[model samples]
Target: MLMKATVSGSDVKTGGIALHNLQKRYGNAIAVDDVSLSISPGEFISLLGPSGSGKTTSLMMIAGFETPDSGQILLDGKDITRLPPHRRELGVIFQNYALFPHMTVAENVAYPLRMRRMAKVEVEKRVGHILDQVHLGALASRYPHQMSGGQQQRVAIARALVFDPPVLLLDEPLGALDKKLREHLRNEIKTLHKEVGKTMIYVTHDQDEALSMSDRVAVMHEGRIRQVSAPKDIYRRPADLFVAGFVGEVNLVPVKLKSGTVHGPASENLPAPEWQEADRDATLCVRPEHLHLKTSPPGSSGGLQGRISGMTFVGDATIFQFRSETGLELLSKVLNVLPETMPGVGDPCVASWAANDATILTE
Candidate 1:
């Protein structure tokens, strides 16, 4: 039941963004190294990484707050590498709401329009329209100090959208809120994106946030992007060890390739990558959910023979820790549909998975 908000003049267009060999350095340390990416118009892309991984630095460069040592930033095919922040006409939302303490919600939402020398009537109209779009029309007279963190964030979003910029840049805008509020606001932001049809670039260290909201995710590590793809691809077919381990809960099993087969402490005669070199050491990455546990006799099933060492019951799933006969530890996650059918600790079990469910990492 949400209404689409419109701005005066035509809607913003051509929001595509391209980065070419972007690099930044501080002292002898490199922050962003040879980072290059292309974002399509109206696409929601998330720059995901841990702290000190240059995600924030990269966003800063795009926002014109920091200058890259070497690179070009093209917005809608126009180079804006050296353009000032204001001239770029990009909307930016920070971790903090950044609303004026003394100004009411209506006043804060009208700030950007007023800065552009917009007329009083037009500014008021735009502010009212945007406030309603964000479900804050009733709170127009509330000040920043009088609102909750989530409300303040919505005001920030409303202020940014009041001008209808072509691209929106969010730097962990929900990082200041609680877990439940963050989840709620992220969905709201996603809905807002669809309604506005503006290109959005969100930067965050939280994997769930990136996987849940982004149309595509660019995973950065050690000052460079390790992989860029859809959320499912990034989670299921990780490019490297860093990506597989960082994106989710994965069990790394060291294995050796002999001929066209793989040999490990708990598994043997496993399928090996066709492109991998023979007699090389590799690691098999498998998610806990992909591993199925059976109470079959050891060596009876073609999988790792292990004993259930421990189990932890989460809300919707139970995590079982398995200790292989070779002393290797592995984890299996199973849904908690029927507790009576669940295996107990100290039960002998075999953990197995299909070949396609595992990714072999050579590095």
Candidate 2:
């Protein structure tokens, strides 16, 4: 039982961290561009992208591990760009569980407090309290080697959070765990985030993890932030073609806006899009779930006539791969409802979507 309901009225309030025009370069390659971002107090933000996207670089710059070629880092209105990692009031958990193998869980968690010259009584109290919080009170005496991956992860979290630092930076903390353990601990992290209300910055390459866990997600690509918004917004209204294709399963078909109408994979013309000055070099962006699959194409209407080339059962939903007369392939997702309503392979289907449900993305 995770004791989340009983946790409230934190002794230490969270502090926000800000990155102003942060830039990083490694020789000739630019690692991070001029990116300015702000994190709210007690807000949980995730920096999400593929490898070498500058998510880790931004986190390291804030953690004082990497010096920004330019720009400043501020902690609750105070400049901390030059502050040493040890001197900054920050808690960090790395991808690998960095626990002392020789030390017991209690000792490991108590190390930070001890280094800060906290009283022995206070350290013991804090260690005990935090161990119970992470449901590790029973394993307090266990060594890192004796614990499972999940257990060791909890120990690392307790150690980082025991001192109740204002800002917590987690760099791929769940990357080492298996899918099941990653999911289980991810929920615990969310519950813990809610229980403690601390400002957290998580770095991950997992889209589902970031979308499900973060209050706001910053999507990075090639050392630049493509977009930062709520998970739903980022998924639905991506800032560009990269974000639309990256975050979730999307069907992108070449679309042309001619005169007052838009034409794409669907058989008919669509209403003009409300966007910037006369830019038709665009693609239609639609999620699989938004596609409405029917037995036949709606004639004279803007619907796609296709064949169900493939069908996949994904527990909660069934995914269908479709191909149109133009040889354009697309995907549509339908929930696992009654068996009678499910479409199967070789079935003729028409995929149509609402005009507002799709977004027009340039480049």
Candidate 3:
């Protein structure tokens, strides 16, 4: 049987979250600076950025945990900027499990229902349902201390969903788990979000996590929403220098734009009619995956030559560090399979990519 996909707050909901010129400040530092964005209904959106970028602060404002210094926050057509935390009807999952060590899994999941004065029978029914949803029904009687980290996370998710809130807010929910466990639970959390069908707003600094899980990603920087788009668009076509560098591994080569083509320090040229006619200063941005490495001498089409500075095996792909004669430090990825003739460290090699492979950025 085909598996049914889980639902996030996006399922039952038909509207989205809108921030209109939202701003928050503390003395001289601006936490969120006139930021605005529209989150589609049911869209899995992530606030992705490094620490102190105001992503968490913006989320707190939406949850009514922090008051915005200016602007409006709207859910659907209603203004919810001033609503209290309890009145906002949002399910919040934090980095910490925040479960009571003394309470059994069932009790922890049932806590939310009890807070609303739900009857004993109704609470049990809801708790049972959520435990089954999180695949912890058999371990319902076990306490937090008795379960693994992943299981504890499931209990937290269960508690968040048991009340059936309108929105689910996850604040780096997988931050504390080990690498393998984090990867496993990432899919699980995504699965639970879909099953619950609640509109969700996830926050994290991990780029891979955001890319793999979110339907759309909001790249935040210096108290602003720098770019908001689908995961592919965010990675393939970044809006600025920050987005390009922050989203993935890439090498940037300074170049000059003349008559619609980009001229790098080396002989390789880029196709850009607009850039050729544009300003003199430009940059060529290329991802690691697009680079081609060769140990032989160049043919009619000569590529940039460089010395292999280092090589590291990362299982699936090997990372090569190259220093071009023109002073460009570049990193390229090669497949792990043999007969591809991987470049050894300190070997002189040629690096080349298609003309269309490089992105021209004026900044």
Across residues 1-363, which tens digit of lDDT does each residue of candidate 3 receive? Answer: 011112232223354677778899999999998787777677789999999988999999998999998988777657889999988778888899799998999999988888899999999999999899999999999999988999999999889889987678899999998999999999987887777776789999999999999998988888988888889888877777888899999888888886666776864664433453544787777889888777754343457777799888899988889888787899998776473577678777788877667777676
* Global local distance difference test of model 3: 0.82
TM-score winner among the candidates? 1
Q: Write the per-residue lDDT of candidate 1 for residues 1-363, one digit (tens) a residue.
A: 111112211222398888888899999999999888888889999999999999999999999999999988888778889999999999999998789999999999999999999999999999999999999999999899999999999999999889998899999999988999999999999999998898999999999999999999999987898888899999998889889989999988999887778888754775434535688888988999998889876557568888999999899999999998889899988886488888889998988888888888887
lDDT of each: 0.88, 0.85, 0.82
Q: What range of 10 consecutive residues in model 3 has the weakest lDDT sum?
A: 1-10
> Alpha carbon lDDT of residue 99, candidate 2?
92
Worst 10 residues of 2 by lDDT: 1-10
Clashing pairs in 2: none
The predictions' CA RMSDs to the true structure, in order, are: 6.0, 6.1, 5.5
Model 1 clash pairs? Answer: none
How high a TM-score does candidate 1 get?
Answer: 0.94
Residue 331 C-alpha lDDT in model 1:
90
By descending TM-score, how would the candidates be arranged?
1, 2, 3
State which candidate has the highest lDDT.
1
Q: How many clashes does each candidate structure show, in the order listed?
A: 0, 0, 18
